[model samples]
Target: EAGVAQSPRYKIIEKRQSVAFWCNPISGHATLYWYQQILGQGPKLLIQFQNNGVVDDSQLPKDRFSAERLKGVDSTLKIQPAKLEDSAVYLCASSRGQGNINEQFFGPGTRLTVL
Candidate 1:
């Protein structure tokens, strides 16, 4: 009955600093996703996981951004040496299945500010 949960709803750091965000998906959900949403732009998928296996991560910036889903439950996203451009909302979502008909439930995002 519970929804997805995220930690540190807001974060502020210098441009070169690193930041990390955490997410716990809804119960019984089999698919999880991490998205980045800049102001005035729609969310962009950064990575997706089906259970504990990574399904997609092509859009993730390997040099600075990384994410992982542990045991098909909790997830974490981190950005190292954060850039000004990385200031945005990091969203976590989960769905029951990978099919098109499945509706994804999103958690309250983590807002990151890079000074």
Candidate 2:
């Protein structure tokens, strides 16, 4: 199976600029997730979608971030008017399901640098 795909791999932007990242889940997978990983910290789930409907997004910063899954396939995450603290790795991941046999597969990530 083909692994997850991401773009740019790296991004550098000044404070208050908007940015967006994309993700495509594994074929036949029904669950997708977006996470923010700060330096020296574990990945924090920003949002989760179970086939186009959001299952969880409590951790997402609604003021600056928004996400969507179109056609229940690929997804995109956007950060508007970013802050200096937003410099971190934005990781996209997907899982077949919440079942015991399912495992989350992560993409390489898009590293954003705010200067």
The alpha-carbon RMSD values of the candidates against the true structure, listed in the order shown, are 0.7, 1.0
For candidate 1, the 10 contiguous residues with the lowest summed lDDT are 66-75
Which residue pairs collide in model 1, if any? none
> What does candidate 1 score in Cα RMSD to the true structure?
0.7
What is candidate 2's local distance difference test score?
A: 0.92
Per-residue lDDT tens digits for candidate 1, residues 1-115, read 9999998899999998989999999999999999999999999999999999999999999999998887889999999989999999999999997988999999999999999
State the displacement of the C-alpha of residue 55, model 2, in Å, after optimal TM-score superposition: 0.4
- Scored against the true structure, residue 22 in model 1 reaches a CA lDDT of 96
- Model 1 TM-score on a 0 to 1 scale: 0.97
TM-scores for every predicted model? 0.97, 0.95
Minimum summed lDDT over a 10-residue window in model 2 is located at 93-102
User: Model 2 misses residue 35 by how many Å?
Assistant: 0.7
